[model samples]
Target: MRTDMPAEIWLDPYRWEALQEILEQDGTDIEEVLQNYLIEVYSDRVPIERQKEVDRRIKKERLAAVQEAEARKVFCAMHIREHGQEYILMEKNGREFLQVAVFLRRYLRNEFTTPPQRVRPGI
Candidate 1:
């Protein structure tokens, strides 16, 4: 969301391109390549010097995925702790909908606070 940060940190065009190439290669396992890339490319930290290019591409989807996963975990825990299989229903435009909207509304309030850590391993 911050424009000052470099793009590649989230969006690795090179890695993606590499994956594309590997996909085209005979007998090249794309999954293996992706696994290796994740392990090798991000296992350490992205240097500040390289952050411009590396961090620039960090995608919102990645952050959203991380955030959503965390939110779901928290939401489920809260639901189990605070409210069991209890659900309410409301008719909106003659459509009955399971209304846990209030819970979700509250969950979203705290969801963005604890973002996934700086996942750039090489930094």
Candidate 2:
């Protein structure tokens, strides 16, 4: 496969041009068609593997953003007791504040918790 050759040719440039011209003529209902064409053209250039990676990256970034937002929300919730009152749990804290909460919860648990689990499993 020659790299110089067009990866994919637009099959209906005339139709595309006609659509554009019609839109210009009537000035309505062209956004959907243009979006479809744009998506088609975009998909053509982006290889399947690259597209997958791009999608994966996009999803990963979205997830990370959500997670960070959630962490902030949780941190804020844990911090503020009322309109003006700041909770001691979140105010006097460092990065290990959440960890402290976890350890405290574990210590307070009454049920038979699992015995100290191995940090590293046998290989």
Candidate 3:
């Protein structure tokens, strides 16, 4: 259940040279080379169940990112409709405009809760 995972690896000069040599060998594609390297490097450190969990989490994150991107697109379109394309472009280039934009965007999308009205007696 580790949330912080390393996305990349750094290989020293000698190992990198060896990897390049392997890549240059006949009929060896990058996918095969990397797969072999991963097996050699992490085969013992990670179990099959852990690898499956990591893959699942990666997929879930990717799907969430796509959904968030779609939602942002919808919010942007709503903003443009409410305040024209020219105004949107003008605000887009301004410093700290994103803070305002996010507030307006969420408001336009009805993502914020409406405040309760104060009651005046016998209105």
Candidate 4:
């Protein structure tokens, strides 16, 4: 991961202070500490209902990502049928569209042989 801090941390004094405190803790995992601190502090900013909605959206997005990855693998397999392996391996345009197409093709074929596992929200 990149070492750069987000602009929000620089803009918020309290957040910066909390970050500094996390950094100052000796022999501890700084990243884990900072993550927990940020989650505890920032999650309070939103209403409970809004947070639930956000959590739901995040879960949906993660599910979509997993589906997309699976579709990409299947799409590559199909593309390899006509265009050869290089077509899937080579850098090319329309990759995102291709993934979607592959997903649709699989759906139409009723070939959901191995569906991606759903991830729990707010992990």
Q: Identify the leading candidate in terms of lDDT.
A: 3
What TM-score, over all chains together, does every model reach? 0.18, 0.37, 0.36, 0.39
Candidate 2 structure quality by residue, lDDT tens digits, 14-123: 88778778887876546655666878987999899999997788788888888987676533113223344332333233446578667445534623255322223231
The residue pairs that clash in candidate 4, if any, are: none
Consecutive 10-residue window with the lowest summed lDDT within model 1: 74-83
What C-alpha root-mean-square deviation, in Å, does candidate 3 show against the real structure?
Answer: 13.1
lDDT preference between candidates 1 and 2, better one: 2
TM-score-sorted candidate list, best first: 4, 2, 3, 1
Off by over 4 Å in 4: 1-27, 75-123
Per-residue lDDT over 1-123 for candidate 1, one digit per residue giving the tens place of the 0 to 100 score: 344322233448798778668687766665565666775765467666676665556676469777977665522212222333333222223221344555455445645354322323332
Worst window of 10 by summed lDDT in candidate 4: 83-92
User: How much lDDT does candidate 3 score?
Assistant: 0.59
Superposed by TM-score, candidate 2 places the C-alpha of residue 96 at a distance from the truth, in angstroms, of 24
User: What shift in Å separates residue 78 of candidate 4 from its native position after superposition?
Assistant: 15
Local accuracy of candidate 4 as per-residue lDDT tens digits, 8-96: 32337687667667777764554566678888976888788989997788788888888987667632222222322121222223457
Candidate ordering by lDDT (highest first): 3, 4, 2, 1
lDDT of 3 by residue, 1-118 (tens): 2354435657797988787787778667555766777777776789889989978998899888889876665222221333322222223233455766785666557675753233
Model 2: residues with Cα > 4 Å off, grouped in runs: 1-28, 74-123
Q: What is the C-alpha RMSD of each candidate to the true structure, in Å?
A: 16.6, 14.8, 13.1, 14.1
Which model scores highest in TM-score? Answer: 4
